[model samples]
Target chain A: MDRNFPQELLETIQKADRAGAQAVIDAWAVGRPFHRVIPELLSPTLETFGRLWASGKDGVSLAEGYVAAKVAEDVLSRVLLDASGDGTPRPSSKGPVLVGNVEDDFHPLGRKMVAAFLRADGWEVHDLGVDVGPAQFVDRAEETGARVIGASAMMFTTAKNVAKLREEIDRRGLGNRVQLAVGGAVFKLRPELVAAFGGDGTAASALEASALFARLARRASEARGEVPA
Target chain B: MNSLERVLAALQNRSSDRPALLLNAGLYGARLTGAALKDHYRDPEVFAEGQIAVREAFQPDLLVSPFALAGLGAAFGSRLSESSRRPPNVAAFAADSAEAALRLPLPDVDSHPQVGYLRDSIRILAKRYAGEVPVIGLLASPLDLPPLIIGLEAWFDALLFQPETARALLDHLTPFFVALGRAMLHDGATALALTANLANRSILPAPVVERLGRPSLEQALAEIPGPVILHHGGCPLLPHLADFKGLPNTVGYVVDAGEDLAAARAALGPGPLLLGNLPGPTLGDLSPEDIGALCDRALSRRAADLQFILATCGADIPLDTPADRLEAIADRVHRAGRVEA
Candidate 1:
């Protein structure tokens, strides 16, 4: 609960170090951004805890895992506020990107984490939340003039919607207009599966995806002979 | 001993030395191992080969669907993307509307492309070994449908915040699900695995699960007219188990590892057969020798009861669960002094 803790929370989260980040998380767990912190920081941290429990450690318990996740969620919700509004201006020339879960998938923890990371990197991101249909994605992309679209789904059942988006893009003749990136638990198991839906690329992790989308958007501009903005 | 006798004896609460295998032939195996379905539709030989492999390997007493729960939702209108590894996924729900819900009619098992594939797979399995192994069809509990329609967040919000709308949507969706179950039963599924994750404690609030899920499940259970086998993952559904017990044709209940079997026995009380609560991480990831040792611990700790059937709490079998390890779990179960052969 040190005042200096949250300043390092994002950095600590990036390192994926649970012990290094726990004090910050425990301090911010009940403060705000619980969902965001849980998956981004707490869940991954507890993932280590889970491994320990599985390996016959006697001290750790599921309750500890739950507490860690809840606290992380709180910090996530709190830190998420004013991030976009208070965001430092876009220092990069790449176009803005929109990310979200498709209409059927409800798991937003992953998507929110990605958004937080992107916001910190100075990309104005519109997170459409979970379960937006194909039309919603197209409408949001066009409205925002977004050159890159990112979608996340944890279940294989919902991951199929990525292909539907591709079909929608082709129907609208926007194939050349935007690049699509897909990620999530399903994609983690099979990165190649994203191509079945015709995405430009797939990210297996938050960092890889944020970097991939920026590069893809820049490349899309270059293909048009525009200087890489 | 054959699987049927082993399973039947176990169900009867008699002691048995012959192990009873009950492996699922779903995408979990294909997902974990990166194996393909070989054929998703109209290939009897492909279906036969996969079934034969499982039959020879596990010699399981009961055969459950090899596909994921999202298959039915996908066949109608959901975007189902398959992977070489992991189960097929739906990117999102159709939308939160009665019209959207109705637009995706329950794909008739005999006609829908994926359902046709499953049915063909079943026919092949049955034809190849009818009396030897009973085939159980997996159906999503109606509570699961609302989430697919409105999205999980919206559905949860509806359950917690807007009770009336949730009730209305559930009222409409429940019967169609029952009809699907009846169709599968007619297609030769001796047992039905009803997965109501939305109703499970992992996701749904206990009171909401009781209020929204219990009634529809009760109706579906009555309509399906077969032994219903209920499953949940992550969170225990002890509060909802009473509702399952109250259903008319309920023959068995599967308590996940999230649940305490001793508590489940106390809740359901000795009539319906209890299957599962085998944690996959514990059972599937260890070596045969290590797993066998853990299996001994698991049996001694729980499942050493008259009414327990052997099964995983949920199906996410690790890729490393060797055929021999699979056999060892069964062998250990058979060797349990209380288990009947």
Candidate 2:
């Protein structure tokens, strides 16, 4: 809440004193939606860390950064898990969503991020994890009666798997039923490539992605007459 | 001018009769050395062998550190499958705990077996070469490192769901790198090379990179006392180039495959040396003469004022790629300037 907090965090990051920044995350982090945390706390913290890490300040190694990210994930998970344990009523008007890293695409960070955002935003989210083939993605989505399907690929070679997933979905006639969303480094490099693969939508950022899926789900619900738009 | 001296002169921005002959052998595969390096994982002999091979053959002006960034995720706690010939691939993380990542004490570079092997490699190379060649050490950036500790899925989830914590993790990770660079320099490394494949134009979005990946890279590059080479292995990566201007001591950049060398020369301005864009594997089994011609085309197209070196993207040089091919490249650089004369 102090005006100097973000500045101090930035300074600490510049000094490569991650404990100082972790102290900030400890202070400001609450089990809140990503949108709320991103603009104020998450955005500032990430912006500072990103800058400092690139600059090579105070001997920060990628291994150390990996440690810090794991730490942050623990803290966030704690908050979210605690809130869930409290049995407080979560808004449940939205339909379920299914997400997974596409086949041969071992990168799942993007998918995980979106799932977390959706969960915090009150959508029932299922993460199928990585190295999943196309049939599995659709099978899981269908079994869960999910309204949205989110897929991700971190590597360029594996991103091609998205097309296979799309083809299978069409062949199974699940294309119209499930709205497909894709994101990651591969999609970012080639924005137009997703359409050719038959993905319904793509998002550039986690926040944008969360919003995109929410909108898509709402549209799908409207088309099914399951809910008023 | 001799090959090494030509590179030196170009690095100093002095006029060179022609572009310096820069030879880079791309080293993937899982081999590493030493107990410190192999403590938690199977030490891929690739690290030691690559260093040895790169040193022996096509002794370039610089030795790019053995492939380590590809394995950072696994070192931090992800499971990785390795092969002798390919890059060690990491399976996604299951926990994705930001808190877990931050809890790790910064690894002392020499204490880590991998780092120890690396130190030994550099020491051996330096002691043997005696300043004849320079070694550029490699490491991952903050955004690049998260996926390893928490697994890719969980780390991404943290990025969206718990961004504050993710940023905190990056903040926590910075000092270890700074220490790593300092350690490498002390161990006889002449330059710091960040083979940030994640920063490739093909992977990370420009705005995201500018917002999250570049700043830390800039800070990291600044801390290295020797030259800094930012290896952007895939695509032009030009969109994010401007974010690098403030890096205090960067020596040059390893441009992506088939990038317009002239455009890269123009874009990078007159300051840094441009290393290469050899489409190593993508060119698909070309002759040494063919490879030499591509190198010539890249070097000659750039302005003489813009120092030029030659290299490949992130992949390792194929073993079948004959030594003569590399030699042919050297021969051409020597003869290239004379043709214009």
Candidate 3:
């Protein structure tokens, strides 16, 4: 679908009017499917919000991006509930995905957005929050039988920790069983860092995280000679 | 000229024999001075000892306190943690919401233990240097304090959703910074450095910085004494350069490595000292010879500017930076000074 984000909704979000923004999204969703709204309207709005936020332009604040993401998350949860009422199996019944910020990094908004997107895409997501160590990630993955682990680092200093986490994951012999994905502002700044840190995959934004996780899952299944579920 | 004279001359926009080097030499100096980072941060005496060793090693123009933002946040009841390698940081935020953050008790700058420790550290450093070298007291700016007081994400949220609450929190915290600046000055600090890590395009949009950050900083700057330097490692200060220049007491701007130095110089004019543009990330990776070459390049680029000071953009020198590489940069600057003489 050719999705044009409503400028009015974007303005409402920028104004910090969460209720008005939600009302606008709800109105738009009256005739549209939740899938269409998420990928087309919501995702594009978030991308635009980020761009404007970073542009240091008028009427944009880091807080507006936070508010927009929160509103989108609420809408996503509601959409998922509504979709589940139609007597269809939830899309995320495939396997659990664990997401978190790497050690020594307190920035978790990226990881939280990735988790929300994955949950919206019908995957069971386990969010480990920010400043998470390698052992915690591995321990949670083992307990939940997570098929994919997503790690994020916001700075070059903390991005170095992702490499350590990757080593710990390999040392534990979970390298093949669990796909390790890494991203954040640092990843975008240094594109080669994904491979440098021994990550299975990387995505530029939370919007692309679901697809990246799916591709990694497919590759993991192929490596195991198992039919793609 | 002595190290102090060289730095003051550069700041005065006069022709010093060479560019003044304001090396951070804080964290790396701790390791070199035989003071563990953990010990240096915990005890004022160890911090003073580390600062003295760093001054002896580099003989740089400025002597910044070994401690950074840990004391300010801790004074306000935020939890702090120390590690062997890294500088201490807020272990946990004091509050989650703007109301709760504003409700945090204002620290008694005179008697607060952390503030007292910082004051003692400054006093010892000043006495040891005996006014030969200038000591800088560091304080986080209003915009930067939110993240330390509350969490980063929540603070950003407050900036967007509840700006009034955010402003009130800053208003409440502004006195503490002013008091800290006054006390440090009384304790013999020659100047104060305010670190505004959040006032950048990467963290907040420019309008928000103008609306929220500028006023709080102006209020604090109005009360603090002159010769205050503004430090923000986030590049692209071009947008907020005007805001900084408008501050009454600001005498210099520290441009991070990736920022446009020419743009900053153009905006700031020749009056305010422009220090830095050195990349901190490559400090550990580059060889001593490479570091000297880098210094030569930076000096040659701004040969005509009389107000430039060679310095690192970041507050803390990277832990792994080789002592020889740092010495090389200082050696290059000193050699340049000798040639000019």
Candidate 4:
């Protein structure tokens, strides 16, 4: 399979032309497995756009990057439905995970990106939505029996409150049962913040987040003395 | 020469004893007073008192207004989250859609309590500091304000796909920018810090910004009584400096923390003062010596450029940023600047 998407599709997304991007995805995705299509095609496109957003290069805008992400998300959703009998996701090899922005952090862009990447990577993500409090995160994780909790905060002030997730998990005596994974622009800017804020781990980008979650998920399983999925 | 003079000298690209130092200590001022962060934000009197404490302690060249977006957002019916632990953030967008936002009324800066809260803070700080220091008034640029009014995603969709709808919102916000900014200047703010996030190249391509962002900024800056300082507003600035050049009343820019200060100064040319590249909220995590070293690096990067001010970049500095961290910065630059020992 060709690793590179058509340059036309790249240009289309850069123009924020949603229909053109969708059409490209429809064509390129033909005869491709959802797993291979996601890991090989979509993730690379996202990483490219993510670089554009990070570098602030001429002619590229975040609007264009947002278009690419939305297209990636759309293809994933459609693939899931086609694979499942009733839109219920086909059984995943991995455990479910929870993701949300910490309480008072209305910045949902980063968290939403993380959700899409996780979903694409085969994790059933229970997105708690923005402005989610610490209790809500732990409670949802407990109810879902999810082992890894990903919390996002864009600002340092909000990032400080990410610790509350750790505090809540410990208070419930789920310290060994549940693991905390944190991220956002702030964490990337200050790599030390992940450890300082009590996150068990962090990833640099949405694509990297899936790998980080996998590692933490393994640790949680081992602590619980369960066989790895 | 005092703080105000040092800032003025930097604005004019004139040589001074050293570069002007602006802490951009957004709400760390409130933290200095030991007031509940929420109370410090809520009560104008508390906010004023806090800035005074910040001033007494650090003697920064500029006093920035509080997160004016939260208060000014109320003009469009936006509400604030109630947080005792940290300063409150906007709990809800004023309008969920761009069309809904356009229908909202433009604020009367003289009477709107939310607008008045910001104006009063600047007034108090400006009045007290008087000729001693410059108070930078915060005014969200027309392109940037819509995201605060309507949510970011909705605004982005409107801006990219529905050009007319976004234009209408920009048209509506431009007047508010002018009015609030003029009022701040009237109240004694030496300059208006035009926080232009949407103007950043990363957010909108240069042509889009030229078509959508520049005209509103051109008009607003021309309308405001004081000179404007173009801030990165949480995004990088150096790449797009050309789009902002030659606007009326624009005196400088606040470089993004991740950007190279020397490059920003070079791109901006010798015309406008460049202030920034320090991460404001991360100051609390660093030692005084580290902060001083970063300050020294910023200074050396400029390498004798008189048109510069050392400042913390991004939307704000953390509230718990230790006083000693700030003092360390002041000891680095403020002590070396113009006439006073």
Candidate 5:
């Protein structure tokens, strides 16, 4: 991965320079596949933007994340469209994935990043956004037929809410069909929390999250004696 | 030595009977002292009575007000709602943008009812303790205040995009803090505990904290007459240790329990007192014996460091935390102090 493009994209996003950030992505994506562009270029760029914003560098804001997401979305949509060549009969064989911040936790940048990465990785993603309750996650998964649900909790206090979602899934007997995946600063600090809170797995970062969910989804399918699509 | 003497000795690097324990026994005060948490925060009389009762029962070195962090924002005209289980929180934010935030008026501390309630409670506790136990008043840090007035997303956005506006907002809020600090000191608060949750690496990076959060904090600390303890929730204070070192009159740094004490001690060096890393959030799950064991371990790890104090990393111990656990901590520290003495 050339660090130059990601570094430049991070600066542009931090400045809330959406046009410049988009241009950078567009320029880089020329004659390249999104699978290469996303994991290598766009995801790393967003991660840098997140780190810089977290660093509290001058002119960095939560809004920068919104801008970065927009740029990633623009590049992703164009690349996917180019690959499909007219968008007439493209079908997603990958099952839908549900992602959100646990109830009472409003920090959603990581979850948004995961949603974007999952989309780029050829999975259907339903982002429930921030402060999503346990019931909402289960209901959305049921509605969307999502095979995996990803919950991000930023604090130890709200991270406890993830357990509630776990219990609800168990009670619904959807534990086998729907796997619960958790991440965030708390999980990074305490990795054991993923299993302790009844989650099937945990990811350390956005890219890892998308990969973790793919593996979990495949394992679920294998358990049901079906070939992973 | 009494609790106050023990803490004072530790702060001055003088020999003490034992390590001073500043357990955040504030939230547990209501339940242990027979005052409802709601009444304890809403009524000055109940607040003082509850604190005194808890002090008598647990006998920790400091008495902290259990008032929610929303008081300052509420005083500045943000809507606050009181609850029975926990402290009041901002029901509504006052501003959404940097320009609007800068224009928000500075609240007169004297005119705010909640401020008066807290001040009265401080005076009552101070007079009751009468130089024995220090009554520390809780004030939201300048960095922590903006998110309360303007919603957190907006405040953080301003921090990333509009640096000057964020600083201006911090500057605007600093006087209110200075006034609040002065009033608390005047009313007998022996020290001021500023909750700077945003200064942690989990939220803001060190450089941004150094640039924006540190200056406003310095301004507020300069006006504060007594010792100022900055309590930041989250661990690995290594990043912000330098910024913490630069602040004036900061006698102690209260970091969360997950931090490596030895690393923090080495990073902080010998000047400032290292007050905590006791797992606060897990207090509800641990028995008194368990808590005592944890405290004993922490004390043993820093046994050679005289400036160490056993305290919680977070401000309020959970409301449901057992009184016995708090007592166990205090008793363990007392035994350690006596044995050392």
Candidate 6:
């Protein structure tokens, strides 16, 4: 949450100096344990990037957002891998989450970006991959106990299949147990469909997806009467 | 005035009683023919028949040829699936990688059915209309074709991380688009609806697009030899209007619904026609009243811009979109009445 951290990182990302951005992160993490670096600095910095991207006033393009996320992803992943004193990398405690292009929707760009951003924020992302069915999304979330499901579809037609995820969730009475986040080109182009598609929420950009999942998780926690982390 | 004359009036920014209606009722047209959407996509006769059927019902100013960008992909050897209700998604790629794509030969539009379907539809409609209406054919620009051929993720990966490789792919794909676009024009297309999403700011930064995407586009547009309308490709165009103005043969842009029309018109400087932006993909879900509100708002906003065409924007119109919803838009454009000179 330090003010000085994000501005420097933002400048590096804006200039598209990936190595410089990594160097900035490394400087911040030099004294701090790398694992704590995410919750303390990296996550908040990503939030700043998300706001800048969503604002569009400062002129952050998707390519920049993708680059920033890629940098964040590379940093967070390496730290998470090295966090354990043991060689094996333990998953982030941010909780389980699933992402996929909804059944019959094979466009992978949006979904891939979402995975990167979530992984950057230390969310344990189970990429359901493309051409995923509705039952499979819910069943995997059930099997994995993932608190959030990000369903992506590029076209309005393929996006319609996302509704089946809502149906599967409700049919299994997992509404309060898990949250559905609908997105992709369709929702971006036709935003009114977020609620129409039964999404608990939708992020404006991939960098924002992690925060959306957190909010959804908190809501699900409240519904289930669990203490918020 | 005939539909063509009205469209010409809009294109000329001439004083007119109304804004020309350029509804892209392509996928929606398949329903009118009583054939499956996939069937209509393949059979030029059925496809043109559907466009004709909709033309009878709606009386749009611009007659749309098959707007499926996938048809161009199919010409390169991609096969699509899950196209029953909507436009088919390319299930298989023409070439899975930039290397393989480079090795793939350019399709002869005259021989390839995928590309020929486009030319055939334009040929059929232009003959049927015979100067009564203008047939606008959809053509994917050179920079946009990598996503169609190699896959969206792979292409974007190469574009973002492997710049030289992406430029090489663009160099290879540029002539194919030029050839098909020129062929479509020669076959009787009044204009080409060129999908140039790569040029839009939302998709890529201006510097990146200007440096990487624009050169190929300028090259392709120079050779097409016909009027070109830059499509939003489901992205906003207002920010890039001034830049797009210089592309040869580009006379209009299909604006996104979310953009400020006044700003777009100002950016375009009254020279280029603006055709768009009813949210087409959600047409089936919106009520008639919602459709009217959107139409009424778009009409009022651009009511003064003489070079304005009222039409749908963002992805294909859902096939199941109620006919009445389209008629609702059509009726509004028709009843929009005279714009002040």
Q: Rate the local accuracy (lDDT) of all candidates.
A: 0.62, 0.62, 0.75, 0.78, 0.75, 0.82
- In angstroms, the error of model 6 at B304 is 4.6
- Using lDDT as the yardstick, the better of models 2 and 3 is 3
Better of 3 and 4 by lDDT: 4
**Which residue pairs does candidate 4 place in steric collision?**
none
User: What would the per-residue lDDT of candidate 6 be over residues B1-341, giving only the tens digit for each residue?
Assistant: 78888888887868877888987788878888788876788888999999999899888888888878876777788877656887767777888777678888888878887887878989999999978999998878888887788887667566766778888888888888888888888888888897888766777766678787787788878887889999888766877776687788889888887678788877877688888778887787789998999899989887778888888887777778889998999899989876667
**Residue lDDT tens for model 5, B1-341:** 78788778878887887787776766667777677766787788887787887777867788886547777777777877565555665657777676797887887788778788888888889998986998898888778888678766677667765788888888788888888888998999988888776665445544567687777777778877788887874545555677677587788888667577888888888878888877775676678878888888888898878788888765466666776777788788878843342
lDDT ranking, best first: 6, 4, 3, 5, 1, 2
Off by over 4 Å in 4: A1-7, A28-61, A80-93, A171-173, B205-207, B300-303, B337-341
Ranked candidates, highest DockQ first: 4, 6, 3, 5, 2, 1
Against the true structure, what is model 6's DockQ? 0.51
lDDT by residue (A106-154, candidate 1, tens digit) is 6675686567556544467888987778889989988998878898887
Task: Give the C-alpha miss distance for residue A127 in model 6, angstroms.
Answer: 1.0
Off by over 4 Å in 5: A1-23, A26-40, A44-95, A101-132, A154-157, A219-229, B34-37, B77-92, B200-202, B286-290, B338-341
Give TM-scores for every candidate, taking all chains together and pairing residue i with residue i: 0.61, 0.59, 0.90, 0.90, 0.83, 0.91
True contacts recovered per prediction: 0.00, 0.11, 0.22, 0.61, 0.03, 0.58
Error of 6 at B136 (Å): 0.6
TM-score of 1: 0.61
How do the residues A100-214 of candidate 5 rate in per-residue lDDT, one tens digit apiece? 9887675666787678767766688888887788899999988987889999987566778899999999888888678889988778767877788888998755655666898
Lowest lDDT 10-mer window, candidate 1 chain B?
B26-35
Residue range with the least summed lDDT across 10 consecutive positions in model 1 chain A: A58-67
Best by TM-score: 6
Q: Model 3: how far is B238 from its true place, Å?
A: 3.2
Question: Local error of candidate 2 at B294, Å?
Answer: 2.8
C-alpha DockQ for predicted model 1: 0.05
- i-RMSD per candidate, Å: 11.5, 10.1, 3.4, 2.0, 5.3, 2.3
lDDT of 3 by residue, B1-341 (tens): 77677778777767778888887766766777777776777677888887777777877888887546765777777787665656776767788777898888988988888788788888988888864888887777777777777777778777766788888888888887787788888898888877776666445655677787777778778998756888865444566687678686898888877566777889998788888877665477678888888788878777777788888765467777778878888798777752231
What TM-score would candidate 3 get against the native? Answer: 0.90
